[model samples]
Target: MSERASVPKEAEETESEPEQEPVTTGAQSVIRALENAGTDYVFGVQGGAIMPVYDALYDSDINHVTMAHEQGASHAADAYGVVTGDPGVCFATSGPGATNLVTGIADANMDSDPVIALTGQVPTEFVGNDAFQETDTVGITQPITKESYFAADSDTVGDDVSEAFALADAGRQGPTLVDLPKDVTQGETEVEPGRPETPETYEVPEEADDEDVQEAVEALAEADRPVILSGGGVIKANASSALREFAKEYEIPVITTMPGIGSFPEDHELSLEWAGMHGTGYANMAISNTDCMLAIGTRFDDRLTGGVDSFAPDAEVIHVDIDPAEISKNVYADYPLIGDARNVLRQLFDAMPRAPDADEWRDQCQTWKDEYPMDYDTPDDEPLKPQYVVEQFSEMTPDDTIVCTGVGQHQMWASQFWEYTEPRTWVSSHGLGTMGYGVPAAIGAKLAAPDQEVVCFDGDGSFLMTVQGLSVAVREQLDITYVVLNNEAVGMVRQWQDGFYEGRRMASEYPWIPQFDKLAEAFGARGFTLESYDNVEETIQEARDYDGPSVIDAHIDPGENVFPMVPSGGDNGLFALNEDQLDMI
Candidate 1:
């Protein structure tokens, strides 16, 4: 669990008492339902339509962090959910406030992160009259949420929220929303909601079928070059320990998807890091060469598999997932074991008779790692390398420090260079590739794990999109380090324009971008700048030493590009190390 939700001692002691229920408004009932669920914190912005709920919150115990924007609130809640297994909660008013949460909701849906969004609606009578600050929020969000609710009655509003909360953290966890109308919230209600529970139709598979497990074990027993592929699902299911034990017992090498970066310690002898576009070359090589692949908790998205037909061409795949619909949806699963990751891995471990003899295969993998090392040159005269900065931070922080990033070259560099030793320590936007996620995510991670150090790596363009988040960090007195790899442009887009679009950079460059360090200072947070390697160590140390929020605007080489590239729809086995190699291919 991220942060364990706990009821008050007074409530726990009075659990068996049957006192008379007090008369309460629907808004008060809503707050009562959250109290029942033991919600620790909620991130949201106040608005006119949601005043009733806010008024009720005035006396409630839940810690509500007021964000600068609805989008930031949603992102913060999303990150909170990512860190903890429980669903993070957020609120927004009708119309624009509700609509602003769309990106974060869509992001959570795509990444399968658990979050609950409560959106206020116009009064029921005025809902369809094109009333001010009203929109068909349910209609707009239905496709993005695991489930959505339109609360029409004051008597059942609390129950509606309870059900929505249950569904958000239930099977294949994702975002769920509750649309509360003003009239319903303002109405009177005496009944309180019961404990949260999913509807009867919902069922979670605990373990795979016996026949499927037997078949998978037989395949593994007969394999020569076997590999274990771990995805974000492993982290979500809290099955990293089971996965590690299974891999080690079977003497199989492990590769991770980007979102699965922290599932296995990157420094482990058997670890090949992650595989996909811009993934480590050794990991991609292992994925291509394996004869039998045991993949767990992954949907095998296109970015990870590249060309579906070519991905793991020589491997007979045994895919394990809780959601049956995802089985064989992308890469064909030779053996489909449908169940929870931890349970299924436990079954596989018990059923397997002996480990495979892949000594030669393991040696070959080590050779590949040596052949394509993740190294870069740093001449003293050249501008600061982003990779060096990432490595420096990685070396400076503890192994368990939480890292967040925005989508761009900086994100890739952070993921590639950092050595992750624990699960839930790597937080970022994946699947949806949402930019401007670093700042708010860092704030949420700090709240989720108050003792752990939190750091965010962002690019200039991405940082500019959500710089307003700095004010919230300062206000909260959160200890977080924000590192911006300012390349004077949208680095990733510019890199792509240079490589794939005949070098015609259109609106990707931002030469007039403001200095982020000064901007952080203006927001009442500590700030520092890095022009070269001369001050890299001292600058980073000063930022880390600060007791409150800080930003390091480290200007980097504009010409630097992310390599180990697999052009869209290309085979993962044939990734290039540079643009020149890409052109030659």
Candidate 2:
């Protein structure tokens, strides 16, 4: 914001001009490296120390989207990476700016998202002096990142960014950090203007041991109630095709973990309806009864697996993941597989010996699906209904479009409504349910995959937290659809209040009705008002058809809650809403 952000440091300005034909500072060199890496956008909150870097970005092709909070910037980048399978980049200042990126970085690390964080550090000479805007960012972020580098020497800025991208986009991709000291950022250097070498290829064991594959095949063949648990790895490893093939050949029910939500079709008969907390009862029951389980690209996080100790007690797990660390990280594996999930499955599919006919296993899962189909009535409920509108939104979009969400009640509703037919179609801060994530994340997703329609299902309260990003979308002219389920309250918290706090509406109201349509228009974006459910569909269809940013403000009952509630701290067995709760309904 300050002109200082556009000025190179006095130290750099005073540096001896390079003897070469043309000379560029380390800032320009780093920018070029990013450009070479195909980084088209950078999410950030600029600051004093990073001014030189910002200066280079002026009219340099790549655009920067400043977020309200640094965390939003990081998360937006994280979501972008997940959506596009490209390394996403975020910039921040030192100290608080760096600290703000912690939660989002941790989320990406936990989920193995490919994110690159570029942070400005105090001058190298000021290191450990507790200099203004100085913090031990690299040390602070080490535990949560796949790899991190701090370049105290300005001469190495380009290389640092280069290596950061390599680590972020390499095998089993995750977060990578580059802390560039202010002094170093200003330093001039002879940078090799070149392409990065491809990361060394690692062999993904295609053929599971014939005996082991046969054993797994026999176990699956023998079980009448077999199930497959897919995870993010399935999508990351591009195993969706193989998973579909295996599921089809075996004819067993295949459900996914939260991150793996869309790896298997929600509409698939073999789907156990997303097994874990907040999932379907029949799916849980199918998990309970299945004697054979195939877990791919999943860590079986607690949310997905009720309790690791008791999870699939009767089943033999055929665990396959690209990362060896994930094989027994959560649920124990009977036949541990360490390789690319897609590659492993491809081999399994080809060498797959005949398994028992799936007539009955598929039949049981189908029966469960038919019996416990997820449902909610029209937009006619108190506290504005969640599912009705979410389902409506889902019905409005094409199957290939993406639906990213913040981690909250609306996220859960989206899980129930929008059925993901492909991987990376639905992204959220699952392990770390951070608010204020939707808008910026939508920006990143739109940048990463401009052709695909990316929508953010934002809760009213959540949207307010990061509403500043609505401007970013408009400024960027991002083709993103924002369908805010306006409960006029922290819907998730209000739900907890209704169920746990005796329906006492304390501080859970957004008294100021945010004219989101006007706000979007204020930023020169298309906006719509669907005050009544009768016009919700038309409004959404119009928004979808629009070529630019759009916001559909659908105001509904405030007391309506996301049902099938698993009371906080309760186990999956205690879910509150189901056919059993229908009597109360």
Candidate 3:
């Protein structure tokens, strides 16, 4: 053969037979886009339809954390976003897998946490044919997600991820869904040269209007007893520094919501140090007595407001939130500012004169502080109290420690009891009240804030839901403290049965929970039991001093119910088990 012909054939053979740099697949394109967006980790369960994304993750640089359930993965992603101020990613497939994620997506929507959800769909041709493992995921999640879309080809996968991230991190951040058809997973594509095409613009957080700022400042200046009610929005809007300055400059007192734990440092003189279902007596009393209240980033949940009529009735309300819909939704605000709390404070500080009653208002708030301080009498009885364990745990950890808790009595107790002195110090899924959230979320929180001490305040009932994750911490060798408030029952259910359901004693009773200390030991974690009230503090100190993950099980009274709970339809001071009703019970 001629030399030229041989050269051409040899080159063709080399191209066709020999290996070269791997060509990009649809899944690779998607993963590359995720990496570009700065995704630190992805939470998901392995599934057939979505395996391509999982496979891509192996080659790319993104970290994947396996979860027992898709719902847990979604919740963990949302919680991670809340703590880090960045969007978190979760993956699942179509049909049951996608359907299972509805609750979590809705929970993120309700609380406005930024989460990006990726799901697989049936092949393009079979989309409407109702093929196996096929469900209309886009339609199903449209109502729940901030934005929803499905891509049929590999070329569009990158665009979908970029869009999902943008929607999640945009103003009033919420969950977003981008579903991919399985056929697209195998297709090849060359990404068009440059960066991912972000949406035309992201929703810049709502800024404070001049008029509202003036009005809010005027109210603060005119009031003799001004109070600042800090909520989750303060932290969400990144307004903690502004809030701190305003509180100090005006000498106004501060109260925080359960989710707003650390926005105002607990050590600050004006800080409420109140939390969750059971807040401090002084916090509640001050709410009713203050002449003016500046409510920021709070939803005014039933637990926070008690009865609508009695909540801050005596005070002139100044509500500020980024979401206009949240304005006047619950408590009627006398002066509602439909803008960002942080921005409004910024504008108010510049335009209005700073009030001069710092000493007087500070003195009155201190009086309430002395009256109903967060003091739990150390009972002489031998059995350990969870309250003592929580207090001691807070003392041992630094002020910036991150506390994540499971749902039920222990969650509310921790919210009411622990002193969170820094923004994002406490994390949980508040709206859905998912049981297994604490342990996995603590893992995610540690990932987000590696410098801070992470603790999980879990109840016996809730801890059992995701006890498998105890192994997760050990395998990763993460430094976290798990404090199990063991009351030996589904305490919240029992409370309702005992109080509202006429003590019928339904399925809420769990006579046997496997030995928790042994369970921890098996997971390669240090475990101990607090047998007496005398040992509670010392035991917690030991748990803190341990080198790795540890668990402290306190034998709290099975009968100790969360108090000051608002009955199904009752208002403030009209609860089934309140401070006033404690003596009678």
Off by over 4 Å in 3: 1-23, 192-198, 356-361, 545-547, 566-570, 573-585
Question: Which order, best to worst by TM-score?
Answer: 1, 3, 2
Better of 1 and 2 by TM-score: 1
- In model 3, what lDDT does residue 169 have? 72
The digit string of per-residue lDDT tens for model 2 on 35-88 reads 657677789999987777888778478878887788889988998888777778
Model 1, 141-215: lDDT tens digits are 999999999998889989888888888887788999999999888999988987677888999888999998999
Query: Model 1, poorest ten-residue lDDT window?
Result: 1-10
Tens digits of per-residue lDDT for model 3 on 11-84? 43345333323437778777876765667788887787788877878876678888767777787787788788
Reference-based TM-score, model 2: 0.88
What range of 10 consecutive residues in model 2 has the weakest lDDT sum? 1-10
TM for candidate 3 is 0.90
Stretches of candidate 2 off by over 4 Å are 1-24, 58-63, 66-68, 193-214, 379-384, 501-513, 567-574, 578-585
TM-score of each: 0.97, 0.88, 0.90
In angstroms, the error of model 3 at 322 is 1.2
Off by over 4 Å in 1: 1-23
